[model samples]
Target chain A: MGVEGVEPHYQIVVTRDGSLDNIEVQVEVSEQIFSDEVKSLEKLGKRLQTEIKDLLGISCRIKLVEPKTIQRSEGKAKRVIDNRKI
Target chain B: MKVKQIAIFLENKSGRLADISHTLAANAINIRALSLADTADFGILRLVVSETEKAQQVLKSAGFTVGITEVLAVEVPDKPGALDLVLQVVSKAGLNVEYMYAFTRKSGETGMLLFRFDDQERAIKAFQDAGCKLLSDEEVHAL
Candidate 1:
């Protein structure tokens, strides 16, 4: 998921709850746009969470990050890292 | 003067912080000052430590997202309005403080405040020109 200037790459991580839990989306944003602006990123992240929940009908938590901080691949970008416990 | 601060990306899970501290401690890296900023999922643990490069390597090898940021360290008298005055000067100079944190040394005579500004040079000039007592890198690390 991405906005105009803020591009987000995400990973799916398991929730803390044991029995039943909503999906969690860990988003890595492009640093060129957000830099370290936490407030702005928080706002954008909330909007993204709302939009995702509405579109997919599956509620999930959003975690924002910087792009280079996340691992990259050679050919196709490895967007989502599945950390969800099976 | 600028001080090197290490920012570690920590997942919001039990024992994450403990694991980091233990890793550093086991490697003989002393943490001088630290601040943890977090959301529900993850936390950013910023630290002023004894050795920058070694600490970075240790943390990275331990599988943590580590980054180094140059921050200004200002020593202010441990009293009321000391920090407010510094902020006022920064605001008056039209500088933005990205983030800031405070720590006290063992001496207790003065307090150290770590400030991150978008423009490092501008902030340094503003604070210096305003005659705010700033700490050198050596001074900060020694503390």
Candidate 2:
């Protein structure tokens, strides 16, 4: 919990390609969480996924990227990119 | 004993790696050794190139995220168990290798390998003390 009050930014997307069903998620975290922190990031992501599945019943894929690499934001920032076809 | 290696962040999509290699080729940046580690969505392309500055500049300006890290280039004899000996030395010294890649020198007599270690100074000292030959940037680039 030494994140220093930095809330991570993440995104989720659900899509079906041909017969394959998939959900992808991207998490934007500070550089401080890295440098031998990959396992921890994956753990946090899986926890979130479990909660989401229990509530919404959908699984997801997760990715991690730097905040600046994605975009600069003044507030909570955009967190979802749903390109799934209906 | 430390060589500059460029790390490029690439999205896991077709043509991304091709785009990077093409751009480097067009700019005349020669790739000496390379490694790619990836997840399902993204990848980190690590490269030892002829010109680090030029490659970094061109790649960054081309909008491909890039960064530089120092790696140690060691020369081991082109024989069986040569690399195992080096790894043994590092392990005995209690150093960890983040990642590594190897290439045969243009001469084909000796094998050249790049190693990234968190404690580079200690790793270098360990290698040196163990009588392993190390290659400078010029020596590596020449081959």
Candidate 3:
């Protein structure tokens, strides 16, 4: 979901009233980064789901959306904007 | 003269940065400066901080692969050729720069830098002797 020279960030959105929400994942990478990582992101999502539920002890049904591109930040990208239950 | 930054080995994926950042945030550890060296499937999360030892412990306790390294934080301008100048200085000292990334934070006039060299101790000595203004651990952490 990220291109080369870019960092990837994801938005975790949860609606109390059951509305389709847009959780933005900004991945800043090079142009060549997107061709790969699509499948792996899906797998990574599954792994995160398990880890979050187990370690953090949170049980919230989440959905995986397509990865989006983000403008490159110099260093240390601010990822994981959790709008869910905020 | 020289400072250590934690280099965390991570398989590139979603939530990887989140996992570390969230943990650090939860522990009241602030990231002073950081970068990630990413290959195809793996990346090294490098960070300078006020508390290097504690940050490494927190990260390891969370099951992260962590390494402590001495990196050179050179303060250069944010303009073009600033990197070139640093390279030239390092090269003049007969040092091979393994990698470098722009700093995450900056003062009003000076920008910070993170550099990995083939030989950090020698490079630091040379850079400092050459008046390269090697940032102290406190300087890098203040970033």
RMSD of each: 5.9, 5.3, 14.3
| Model 3 TM-score, all chains together | 0.58
Model 1 over residues B17-131: C-alpha lDDT tens digits? 9999999999999999998887766677889999998998998888776777788999888888988999999999999888999977645578889999889899989999999
Displacement of residue A76 (Cα, Å) in model 2 is 13
Q: Identify the leading candidate in terms of lDDT.
A: 1
DockQ of 3: 0.02
- Two-chain complex of model 1, DockQ on C-alpha atoms against the true structure: 0.17
Give the poorly placed runs of model 3, Cα more than 4 Å off.
Answer: A1-86, B78-80, B104-108
Question: Candidate 3: which docking quality band?
Answer: incorrect
Which docking band does candidate 2 fall into? incorrect
Interface RMSD of each: 4.4, 4.3, 11.9
Model 2 lDDT per residue over B80-105, tens place: 89889999999999998777889877
Model 2 CA deviation exceeding 4 Å by range: A1-11, A14-24, A27-61, A65-86
